[model samples]
Target: MKRFIAVLVFAVVAFSCSKEKGNMVVKGQIKGLKKGTLYLQKMNDTLLVSVDSVKLFGDDKFLLSDNVESPVMYYLTFDGNTQEKKIMFFGEPGEITINDNVEEFGWKPGISGSKNQEVMDKFNEINQQFKLKRLDFIAKDMEARAKKDTAAMDSLEKEYKKMVRRRFLFTTNFAVANPDTEAAPYIALSELFDANLYLLDTINNSLTSRVKSSDYGMRLQKFIDDVKAQEKK
Candidate 1:
């Protein structure tokens, strides 16, 4: 009786441990994906490593589970014969759901679960406007070059610079307004890095203390220091 009770207690403890292991759950369905593999990848130091994977055969559904220490960027990569597609998302320690059609894989899919992801989606929506403007500039530049119109080419170059400055200002504003989020520092470094050093310093100084101590925040500070050192030389 004593041995049996001990075995039962051990079983209960083992089940509890298993339940507490996984902190993040990712479940999704890919329409028209008959047979393929799905990889859930995250950056481990400098390398993008696959933390979880699922092999699907004649099924369009998959589930992946892992533990995340904080809000971080993650990738959902589809391995197929003809082409490979990857979707990036800011993942947190919770359940996230994604739904996408394999036929239209390159387009943004529906993702839900993390607040950081929602912030990223909002940023992308605004960033798309700038992207369209850049495309228009590219088209006009090409046309001017094809016609050998030096005056038009010069005008277009000025307009292109104005557009770049406008985009940089918008990014800086967004970072300043959303200082508590990880996306703020990320955009300051990734999107507005080429802007004026004073503008970068402004964004960095505006971040909250908690955000300033974050991983991306520290990186951004270091980047600014490096750029200043270069300028001094």
Candidate 2:
């Protein structure tokens, strides 16, 4: 009985130690991004499981580690935006690296979003729909411009503006509903800016402007500032 008890104790300790060894290290680089936020999420049907979040370094380097099981679909996001480009991984318990261009991935300043698997699918659909419509109008307008058909160009411009307003409304609602989603805030804020631009263009278009020049601008700038600060640690 004594020997059996000792064996059981040893087995328990070994199990715990083995579990520790499974700590996964998720590391990556974001090019063209000075400072930004990132999140690691577990995919779910109704909502995403927020496993971890990190701010990227000045050089856009980041690292996250946790004891996750094998064959997990882990997602990486920037600035909590569900629409931000993401890095996907399928590793057991080790180091993984992603080197991506943030700008090319659609990570623009003042927008919030992610690029996770499910989120990406939805994003692509929304964007494709928007793109097709916009492109059709743009092509028509370009042809009109070449022929100096000011009337057609003017009509197309009005159509484009109307489409923008509709798209903004759709985006705002989607972002509001998915507030917890990283992409939600970005889309919502972007729509807000577009809506406000007609009145705020002069002040907003200034090149050397500080972020605190406006409400949404300040909030987003602060968010970026906070994330970058964390990366230093």
Candidate 3:
């Protein structure tokens, strides 16, 4: 009787642990997607690998669940009859809900339940401002070229370089200010890779120990090492 009781207690504990392992759940709803497919993908080295997928037929709602070892970026790929759309978000271990229209899928959807994704959205808002400024500069440059105005073209070229420099500085500052988050190292590597090596090194050094040990952080460190090796040649 005593042995049976001990074995039963151990089984209960094991079941609880297994349940906790698959704690991340993602539910998505697309208003106009009657028949399509949704894929939940994550980066594996240089490839986007599907971790979960669901087929939709006469319904717009689908569910995906997985065990996330750490907070990382995930992609929701929607395959419709005419076109495909991909939306990215930072995924953590919890329930995340995404709701949007299939017609305007990439235009931004209602994403909630992940704090890291909130931070990413905030960063994207600022990044969009820089993108608009670049577009304006290009328009002005085109006008100068059409007029054959050499002096104006030179001036606009200088201004365009300055704008590019400002964007790099903004990325550097964002990484430095958000050193505790995984996004910091990610932005440092992805956005500021072409910046000065010293600047990149500074951002890497400023990262918190937790961020430095993250998946993106390790990638950033490897990028810097590769840059150093190329400089030696």
Candidate 4:
């Protein structure tokens, strides 16, 4: 009876460890998050459902996990509906580490351990430049409108359209270059959804079969098909 009890205890301990870690292990620290509830979330048919949560009374470190069916985006946020104060990262079936300060939680987080997130980080770095230029153009346009300068307003509008086209082309090329990663489809679906069909098709055709079958990949394919069907009508 003693030997049987020892075996049962070991089994129970293993089961508990597996249950806590799950498939995707999300463990990290928010430097100033002293006492608050953190929730790990993902989209399930448009709903942001929490997979796991932890309440930290003293320590800043936390652990949350979920069984990822396939690699997708995830949100790490605090309790209640504070959507703005959260970190969004690409979640996969491995351990991911996220460390940031509570002051600038999502502004510039240091996320590692996922190849997809690395790709996203690189893309975002370049995209930020385009976003800044867009802001400058918006401010100039507003100034022109206030002064009733028709010629300046026309020039600004034309320049803005050119910048938009450049961004679209750049995004399409980036997606094509990273064809094997699931991020490619996601980039096309998110960044170039409203772009010309030709550009969207180019990115879609360049995706690898494995990535083409991913959640975002399948969604991109469906989105393209739906658009084609609409045009046919």
Clashes per candidate, residues 3 or more apart or on different chains: 0, 16, 0, 0
Per-residue lDDT tens digits for candidate 3, residues 149-183, read 99999999898899899888888887798888888
- TM match of model 4 to true structure: 0.91
Give candidate 3 misplaced runs (Cα > 4 Å): 1-21, 81-84
Per-candidate local distance difference test: 0.85, 0.56, 0.85, 0.91
Per-candidate TM-scores read 0.85, 0.39, 0.85, 0.91
Candidate 1: C-alpha RMSD after superposition: 4.7
Clashing pairs in 1: none
Best by TM-score: 4
lDDT of 2 by residue, 1-233 (tens): 99999999999999856633336676666777777777777665457676766666677777666675433456667774555466554333556555667766533221111232234346546867987999899889889999999999888999899998877666555544443333433333444454543223322232123233433344444554455577589
Please give, for residues 1-233, the per-residue lDDT of candidate 1 as tens digits: 99999999999999856644369999989899878888889888789898888788999998887887656788888776333567788777889999998877747799999777888888889999999999998999999999999999999999999989899888888888888887788888879877899889999999888878877888889999999999999
lDDT of 2: 0.56
lDDT at 39, model 1: 86
Ordered by TM-score, highest first, the candidates read 4, 3, 1, 2
Query: Could you tell me which residue pairs clash in candidate 3?
Result: none
Considering lDDT, where higher is better, how would the candidates rank from best to worst?
Answer: 4, 1, 3, 2
Clashes of 2: 16
Better of 1 and 2 by TM-score: 1
Every candidate's CA RMSD: 4.7, 15.4, 6.6, 3.6
